[model samples]
Target: MLGIKVELIDKIGMHSSDTAMIFLEDVKVPASHIIGEEGMGFTYQMLQFQEERLWAGAAAVVPFYKIIRDTAEYCGQRKAFGQPVLSNQSVYFRLAELATEVELLRSLLHKATAQYCMGHNVTKMASMVKLKAGRLAREIPDACLQYWGGMGFTSDVLVSRFYRDFRILSIGGGADEVMLSIIAKEMNILPSKKK
Candidate 1:
């Protein structure tokens, strides 16, 4: 621990957050500090990741709903041409579609949570929720931001902040690809490895 060094890496978005690369040199961790069994660290970490992905999926639902609701409100007040932007069929319809998607994700999250509470394995469901959450986090903001027009592109607005922050949902808590792989394995659809 004495020789360990941490360096921060500047990222394109999430400017308000911290991302650091830690370099461990001659680091020795005591047996007491090890989580769970000595040789079971990877298993423990995977179990922890299941909880993390579930939490990430559940947490994303509210913000997505808020973004859509807020954007809809903004559109109602902000006029384009001779009428409010929300009055346009395309705008309202798109909002409806996004809202439905958000609701679906929310339902999936709840189902997974209930299963987990009943002491059942939620691995497959959690992976699905994580995948959906990540996709929605990307899709919802992008769609809503369009109605914000120029303001959404600027850094001053909340929508812009959401646009930046939500991008990490797909990459963090197990990436979309990783989640897909997990789901595929759970479904027994992945091709078996050749020895």
Candidate 2:
């Protein structure tokens, strides 16, 4: 704890969950405090990231579903052109698509969890889940916010809050590019490096 300085980073998203930049200035950590064996930190962290990816993917399912429902409800009550905005073919159809996408992600997350519980390695499955979840986190909110119209841009609405919050899914656990690389490596499609 000594020589450690913590500063909260002011981020556009994830306001409730505070993110910080930690500075370690010549901190002395006892060997007993070290996690696992010496020189295995990288291995340990990599192993932890698999679980993190799965969690980030699975956790997003219900929240986005709620967002979709709420946005739909709002649109149904709100009128445009003398009819409910949701009555438009474009609005409801897109909402259906977003809902369906979340369902698919939920299925994938459940399958990955089952395999994980059975003591199977799920790096590929987790990566897939994470990648899809990250994309949807972006897509679903953006679409829903558009339906919210000017209100979506404001901080008052839940859609706006989620827009800020969930944007981290793609960048937090692993960037989309990193997830793709992991999937590619697992698929045997990534080119081998020249030795």
Residues 51-104, model 1: lDDT tens digits: 888898888888988999999999999998989999999999999999999899
Runs off by more than 4 Å, candidate 2: none
Can you write out model 2's per-residue Cα lDDT over 1-195, one digit (the tens) per residue? 688999999999887788889999988889899888999988899998879989998799999999999999999999999999999999999999999999999999999989998999999999999999999999999999999999999999999988988999999889999999999999999999999
RMSD values, in order shown: 1.6, 1.3
Best by lDDT: 2
Task: Compute the lDDT for candidate 1.
Answer: 0.89
Considering summed lDDT, which 10 consecutive residues are worst modelled in model 2? 12-21
